[model samples]
Target: MFESFWRANGEEATIVIPGWQTMSYFSDVSNLCWFLEPEFAKQIRRLHGLVGNAVVEDRHIVVGTGSTQLFQAALYALSPSDALQPIPVISAVPYYSSYPAVTDFLHSGLFRWAGDANAFQGENYIELVCSPNNPDGFMKQAVLKSDTGKTIHDLAYYWPQYTAISSPANHDIMLFTASKSTGHAGTRVGWALVKDQEIAKRMTKYIELNSLGVSKDSQLRAAKILKVISDGYEFPNSIDAKFFDFGRNHMRNRWERLREVVRETGIFSLPEFPSEDCSFTGDRTSSFPAFAWVKCEWENAQDCAAFLKSYNILTRSGKHFGAGLNYARVSMLDRDETFDVFIQRLYSIK
Candidate 1:
């Protein structure tokens, strides 16, 4: 049977992620302020430990509207003066779209997005690296070893899907959130692992001024749920037994189905999944949890996105993600039936 990159194989099904339990009460009634328990705080610290560097200290957990808020704060903290000589934000091509957005929002006059690192002239800039990156699931090897520099690794998808239990720390300020890992996007809980004291202090100050020190209640809830997921062990239970395995199988199957759809249809293209090195060993085709990036040469990325929307299928076009406007991103997290539907629609592209 022929396959395309946009479809899911196997059983037809409908699926929604059953991960976060924190948002249940909000449906019934909403309250202005929430309360927190002490134990919950302790557990959050433990969850922080799971993804944190053992040697790194002075870590503080602050609940954000989302990690996006922290990203803005980081930009402001590292912002420069003068519009012409703005602090250049260096990021890999095809990065998280918001890297430039948050930078522009917070300090538009003082900062600008610098796409390539090689073209950079000097050492006075901030590099935002997203490991297990958004558009493509590629993680960087390590940050450039420099004392005057600060690197923030957005490990938003750093859970069992892409990383090992003992993956070494990649950068000074490693960002992690409960959204992608535990499927708790509603909690708006995220933490930054900062190795620099002054930068860490600045982040704390920004949080204090930004949202009044993040809700202790939300932090506690996020921590409590994290402890339950963490169980008595270091890794989350999601990976211990067969949860991670099932996810991997499901994702790989989805990717294969999608690949077949693309190969057979021949309307679009894709990045050949790279071979696994010791640092990253997983199914290359479907290793990513939520989405896969597609290389579409014939259509503008925005036009492609609009075309998919006509079929009632949503996709993230790459125009906003970076310089490339010829690629699109589609999620593999949908149900089998939805994937099949997507594939069927994809076949109609040509």
Candidate 2:
């Protein structure tokens, strides 16, 4: 869908990298901190300022291959290096599916994957709070209230297009991705905004040891894309339409059409989101989530994923997200043709 939009609206957002451009692995004066590209860092701040979705002031930026890397980096940074026992890392039910894999794959002594935040009874822990959560698209908060517990706010879907940007998010550790915000998943670029300098250094160190540093080419491209987005907000008609406006309109329409189809089937149910005033847009708007959390309402269809899979409609089972088998997740960010086919298949199902 976004590719079609880019094709129609002019390709001014496109970036052409020269052969010699960003040849060096180093992005700044210090070779130690190669994870961050100076231009990309500046552009990120500018973009966040224009959108008002995140607070950039007084925060240290740490660039990663993507938010996935930053998630692990945050885990590494927060875990105690000298502790005898491993720190528990957790999120609420229906959380991001990859959290467990990412936390436990290394089998590091610093941290270990703990099931759910509500069930966890620990003093020192790392809680991941994904506002505008992945599967269900609900706003979330940290359930663990211990002072020793650290919280990492995953704000990947907290953009104005996905959800209302009521105010600037000022969390100690926040993660944002270019894939969800700019539809640049191929670029493999994401960033973390850290309030604490020590934590920021540790996260940057994690990136340094993990992959040496992020790709310079990807960083340059991300900078260009972010610059385009920021510039579009300032000069709305420069590219005939702004990126957020286009995305928000497209997502809202898709959600409406999907809801209509599901309602007609009467076998599936979707979560309802309330309308709220978006400070950036200056209007009340409902959420246009990136994924559709569909629940099987029919008594016969206990496993929603299996039911969808029978029709060749692939979906992420809710069991992976710690939910019942009746729930499943479908992407709303697929291409226009794929989305149309999905709607057709969904409507045809009795």
Q: Report the lDDT tens digits of candidate 2 across residue range 217-286.
A: 8998899888877877787766556888888999999999999999899999999999988998898999
- Candidate 1: tens digits of C-alpha lDDT, residues 124-166: 7788777677877765543444555556677777655543434
Give the Cα-based TM-score of candidate 2 against the true structure.
Answer: 0.97
TM-score of each: 0.73, 0.97
Model 2 spans with C-alpha error above 4 angstroms: 30-32
Error of 2 at 95 (Å): 0.5
Candidate 1 structure, TM-score to reference: 0.73
Error of 1 at 191 (Å): 1.0
Best by TM-score: 2
In order, candidate lDDTs are 0.59, 0.90
Best lDDT among the predictions, by candidate number: 2
Task: Tell me the deviation in Å of residue 96 in model 1.
Answer: 1.1
